[model samples]
Target: MTISPQDLLAAASHSKAWPFQEAQRLAKRLPEGKPGGVLFETGYGPSGLPHIGTFQEVLRTSLVRRAYEVLTGGVATRLVAFSDDLDGLRKVPGNVPNQAMLAEHLGKPLSRIPDPFEKYESFAAHNNAMLRDFLDRFGFDYEFVSSSDCYNSGRFDDALRAVLANFQAILDIMLPTLGEERRRTYSPIMPISPTTGAVLQVPVEVVDAAQGIIRFTDADGSVVQQSALGGMAKCQWKVDWAMRWVALGVDYEMYGKDLTDSGIQSGKIARVLGGNKPEGLIYELFLDAKGEKISKTKGNGLSIEQWLTYGSEESLGFYIFANPKSAKQLHAGVIPKAVDDYWQFRAAIPGQDVDKRLGNPVWHLLRANARHEGADAPGQGETLPVPFSLLLNLVGVLGASATREAVWSYLGNYVADADPAAHPALDALVDKALAYNRDFVAPTLAKRAPAGGEVAALRALDAALAAADPATSAEDLQTIVYEIGKQPEFGFESLRDWFKALYETLLGSEQGPRMGSFIALYGIEPTRRLIAEALARA
Candidate 1:
């Protein structure tokens, strides 16, 4: 099969994600004829509230779907965001409302637990709804699946029978991987207890593969004969993973690095069961600021709500791009960089190969919906007159009380050469900067005393502003700042360090608007006044 839209091939060529490269291979291997459509599956265990890690799964899958569409010239595609709600609730989360209520439902399937928040039918449903709500809000094109429903409605009956029939083969793949104690009691099928309604993980005394039934000793010490079909039984995780791929005919998927071994075994079992195992890519897990694994239970990293509250969906999309395999810190501190980097990538797309633009994160970010033609080009949308970092700094300099209109007016004057209204994304940009300022900036905003060298440099900068010709342009003011940064006594390592000192000393933020144009906008008198204050404090 020929992958159309050469840009898709270029993207896969440059992509660091194994899933993209695997996707390219899959496209090439497709049977020549009318395509049956591509299916990508992303699974979520709704044991706790849906978190950022959950979002990453769907987001990563979406990227592959985008690549697949481009490769097939927009062929039919379906992304299944499957919820493993049938998973047992091993422990109660402390973060949810009414912890005592969840303790009552411990050891039950997550689908059976009451919604602690009293919002949905059950805990799993609540979390699943939350997941769907966010995906819908983000305009993600996906089909949601409930594992509980899939099993209850007998949709997985054939896959369940396949596992029962190949019980020893599946055991051969799993038993050696476990410890001595675990291997003694391991069973591919976990029967739902008729009395307690709990998922029973006991050892099977008899495997009637021909009859598709298994007999296991229940908690009451009774030998219960259960049919390994529908809701009565569910396969263990690895088997379940493979079974889903076969049942759904998934073409591609992505998983966490932690699951690499499980994925390998699943592939073997899938191929053995006459199922087409989906190609997958394993990405490193998200880490907190201190480099610990981001846990929904521990709440070590930014939650999806927190991220969306402070940054745009596009910014979060960019954060997941380019380095799927490498470990990266996912925290509030990285939010600003993600936002600024997105704008920078979008701004650079116009001058390069438009056909190869599918490789660019900005292309997926800005035009994933394809509401308009030529959306991949940087020139298609209103370009920001200033970098987002500057606008964020403006939030710090002007204080939080400044409204969006006020910020835009200030930007219009700051970048006098450009039209603020022409930038179509200005509204969202301003909101992001302001929200970022409130969350990560304002609480920490406080001026610090300058160093002795900084004082001397500030005095020199103050004198330059006070004595400069009134006709000095923004370019001239920028040169003055750069020249001052080069002075030896200031101990400035580079122009960047000088600017850092200036921002912290004047605006009380780590970063701010470009000082040259800022100085031009604030004028000589105000600029000198701010500098003099810093010198006195030093």
Candidate 2:
């Protein structure tokens, strides 16, 4: 596991990935021979059901943690997947099972709200279970920390004392960010109401930092005193974030772009509380394809379950890995491109330098499965098969089948002479593509017409392909396809557009596999007949 410092430095300087750069900065920030392992944190708000955005934060932070491990010679690292379920329910969500029941519990901590779904003891417990289930399904390694547990078990008591002692300093850092009315009512600690059991946000009447207690005016006009330790009281979120950094000894954490101000305020509060702030990264939020923000409240984006249905989990990981800070679209349509990109990256891994190989998203995605836990070193992971997008197209072309063996037989015709079991990853992709095509791809199939010049080009390509041998080498067949696109009759500005026309007319989509390999595998005569039929209909 030991890596040379030079190797770590090379990763920092040569890689363009954000996680790598963040890890490099982290390594330098820590003093030489620091005693404790690095702690990476991602927080979830359990106000409603868990969603894809929640997964994105953990995945991004975990990637950075993995990169850090590589940089520091397998240095000890821990990722704390913390959930802020202790926070009060601000509003009733439109999507949960029983809206009326949730509405009645507004202002109560999520942990105290009864589960409308009847599956768990409380709403928070149900959501937390969803989080753990999905993460475990992806084989993510981490310790789950519930804010309620940290508070109720007295684990946050020491940090609570620190916040109480520096109450004014923390308030000073936060008040300017609030309007005058909020500033007047704001207190860094809110007591759990003894009567209604809601988290009372009323003004604090007195603070006894010396005794670790606070007195606050409740919403119903009673003055109540509660110990800051245990479940009696909890720090406000900004203060809580800083306290968690100190109590958990977190080294790095990330938040959404919207939390820029909160991060700044938390860092200042952490400094005042006698702890250094964890290094923070802010990622741009996901947007829907229509360019509107993807929000849990709006229910605008695809869910984790939906994403998994249309695409492999590794594809979703690649989508997140690409431009981590850029605002990317989270849609079902993006899944195919993600799958193709994963294959491309996996294909490039052989004989690559350490830095170049780590740049591949597959390298990070592989660690999601326990089987590939220690496969982090350079040139690791099994080779992938032909792009899943291609298999999906092939599935569409081959029509419905009674069994998967028929589909594998079609694939063997293209790959030529090699047993697919020799490539387990590709074999798995074939199974996935079959199911994905039947469920998602088949229902969308439609006939497409050729454009102005495409008709003649299709005609010529069809004739040439009819005469070409199916046993032709992939390289030679590929050259023939390229040459057909170059014909003046096509007037294509690029070879890509010509290929796009072929895919549209043949597969009912504008994207598919390499024409040479596809034609050779699918049988050139059948392709010629397919093209000629389309021409006749046009």
Candidate 3:
């Protein structure tokens, strides 16, 4: 069945995948004579490490494709992730290896640079391969295209000719629009001299299609020769952008807000190309964390690996899904809240305003969660640590007997000291419970286990627990330990030393959270069992 604009709107409202209005407009503008389909494109310049921001753009496009498919009853939609490997290296990022190599590879294809890590054949190949692997791992079914391949294949010849034809038109328009100063130096393309940073602004002599050559005179009217790369051959960046959309049949594209003027210029070029301007163009703002834009060039980008280390895949997904198309700063800490908000929205949406625009934040979170839910690590739910330290302690106190029911029982009776209420807080608790199950249940410690002295201290604590009255509550036991600790020979200092030693022996660490609380949570039996096992190993 063909998807209608209404269907897209409904899907956007329910799924919050993209801006509802934008989706609606795109759906309405879909070619009427053709069978229903959509093409979304996101491009990446593989000049450096593929940071989380790269994933954000590509994944967002993928989400839009998925949304279209779902709305169109599984009709195929294409998502293209273009790697601009032919782009010149303007600057060497600090993290890149062999910074000096950039000088040799300055104007050459990025794929020609030797891989600094020696993992891939070239620097460009290494970054592109890693990015491709990451996208594949995340289940983004994108068609990967290398700029070098496109150029060599001559797929952009017509678009290139169009660009050259409109060179004077672009110049006239740009002069009036961007002002006279820019017009004086601007050519339709940026043809920089290898010897100097001067622009070559003379009339073209020949456009040699067979030889892929373009001969032009220099500003001083000196003859100069340059080879044209085929794909949209040798056009200015803005003109080239418009040509890309027309040549590639792009239906939707997004750009960062920083490129607003370029996007506007691209739109103008689209009119010149006689191709349909994209149905919608989204402008996304930079994502900042703690007052810093997450940028690789600025050494402020957060790596995806680091994020996965601390957060669940779902949490990461939620961050992207909840953000808006508008220009606004964002922080990483906002991710958990986005996840929480998405879950709440999913729960609330069945009866809410059916036609209302779901807030961008809510939509972003839901889409992100949906996308990540499929590829997440197995047993993730069982591995996530509980959010509250007290909850973890409580889980430990319940020990091997810990279950959802047991946890509620302890929290109701001892911890919160209140009867459980059927509210959002309870839902939060359930979420924490699931996270704990995913992250902490199957603890994998490093090879170097706790030390012998630490194990002895844990054994002493276990012996003390065994000798204590069973009828005495956990609080009473703490009181007894405190009283024993007050003795001059076994003072608070000794207790601190003992706990530190125990941590080293039991967990192979110098420190951990509260010991008495930890023992109480793991339950007396499990704590003793773990201690004994650790002591034996030590």
Candidate 4:
């Protein structure tokens, strides 16, 4: 039998160490059945760069869906990510190109703003595209529904009417629950404009579904209007959540710790709508390097784009996987160590003593990597390296490889650099490195080359190789080169000095993995030829 989301939830709930009490409570609240199973939903306001937190929500929900599907022997759950593009601008995000546009967009939907990136038609579209791209990159299969699309499709009409009708009931329930000031400020369905500090009045009577126009009356009974054109209509943020649960028939939803109180209030609204309240799971906020909660408006969040650039997909995955859904701060600096640990855990699990505390997922990933490592063509075993180590090596090699021949030459030198006496373990490490490099590093490297002295070092190395004796071993050559540096002018044991000179002249880093090992794996001839050519260009 497959592991299902329910089984996973059950396992999590029963575990004495499970940190999320809310998740346990929400799981208990779920209706009994294998039929009409949970519909997991996570909503994000599409206003700026979707951060790692945004991805975490979708990923977490998807994991739940996977768990359910596995346990049930069928797809028992659906994971939906709702883009709340129809949400009005609450504040101008700090890094946004246009600050003045925020005022015009106040009390208006985000889908209405001109895209600062100019690629997408609107601000919402740009952000939505970013998020879609992010999720797609992570191989997450999800149903994406945009608020603008849903509202324009008239999917929310019934729910909107339901909400409007029970607006009084919503008010009655909320008024007593909230303090006097907050009660007056709160509405049954919509969020007040945080920027304007005004209650957003939903237009009434202009309900032309065909034209997507909705008319509203101001407090003074003056005519006010907005259009749900392009699949969006004005809806209060809080009310919209309830309406979405009803309209989309969501069974489960997760929220950030900051929204715990609001999530509770939303549950009341869900009851008022005569629909089952979606199970709410509250996860803690992720903090930036400085330990402050990541906030888009404050430009304080680490973006998914930035994370992808600096870290591997597995690194990002481990970040979300390892973290408990509680009020805790996550540090960006911890990612590299996490990745290293994940790799170590992966390596230690196959045919080794299994540490009970390390758990199954770590074992699964290791076994997966091991399977991949085993499947490569025979005899090429010596060429491969560990994924992380390969990254470290490529950071050096790519500094010099400006062209295909240069890259090939670098690879040749890399192969030549390997020590045959080096343990079979080293070979395995190298194999994984090659795999990671081919699959991940090359694409990112192809986008942009190194700049400044790194490039110069590569060029210089190329020139020096062109002039060197073809038969000279990489080790002997390096020794001679280092000897030259031992001169008084170059100072004592100055590998840095030699490296700086090489980088300044060739455009590669001064210090890299063992040059002997690199050159052995990469042939001397290709290294010489490519380096010569690069020097000529320089």
| Maximum-TM-score candidate | 2
Number of the predicted model whose lDDT against the real structure is largest: 2
Tens digits of per-residue lDDT for model 2, 1-538: 3434677556755477777788778888863325667888888887765678878888888888877776666778888889898899998877788989988888898998999798999999999998898778778888999999999998998888888888878888899899989988899998888888888777774467867878887778878787878888778989999999999898999889999988988999989989988886888998998989986667788998888777777788889888777899888778888877877776666655667766767777665435464434554534554667767777888776524677677667666444766766677667677777877788887759887888888888877776776688667888988998998767999998889888888878767788877876667776787787778767
Among all windows of 10 consecutive residues in model 2, the one with the lowest summed lDDT is 373-382
Which ranges of candidate 2 are over 4 A from the true structure?
Answer: 1-16, 31-33, 367-371, 376-381, 398-406, 416-424, 427-462, 485-501
CA displacement after TM-score superposition, residue 303 of candidate 1 (Å):
1.5
Q: Mind giving the per-residue lDDT tens digits that candidate 1 earns over 1-538? A: 1223565555555564444565576676552212567787888888765667777887777767766665555667788889998877788877788888888777778888888989889999999998888777777778899999989888998888888888888899999899999998898888888888788788874467766788988889988888867787777899999998988888888899999998999999898788877866789988999999987558687877788777777788798876788998989888878877887777766654644455567766554433324344435434556667767777777785667877776665556544445565766778878888877788898887789688888889998888898658778999999999999988988888898999999888776777887877556776787777777788
Off by over 4 Å in 1: 1-20, 31-35, 205-211, 367-381, 399-409, 415-424, 442-460, 463-473, 483-513, 521-523
**Candidates 1 and 3: which is better by TM-score?**
1
Q: Against the unseen true structure, what C-alpha lDDT does each candidate score?
A: 0.77, 0.80, 0.58, 0.56
| Descending-lDDT candidate ranking | 2, 1, 3, 4
Error of 2 at 222 (Å): 2.2
Per-residue CA lDDT of model 4 for 302-421, tens digit only, reads 666655545555556566765446554555445445556555544444433222222434432221221233211232212224334434454335543433334344444434444434
Error of 3 at 407 (Å): 13
Predictions ranked by TM-score, top down? 2, 1, 3, 4
> How far does residue 164 in candidate 3 sit from its true spot (Å)?
1.3
The clash numbers for all candidates, in the given order, read: 0, 0, 26, 65
Candidate 1 residue 27 C-alpha distance from true site, Å: 1.6
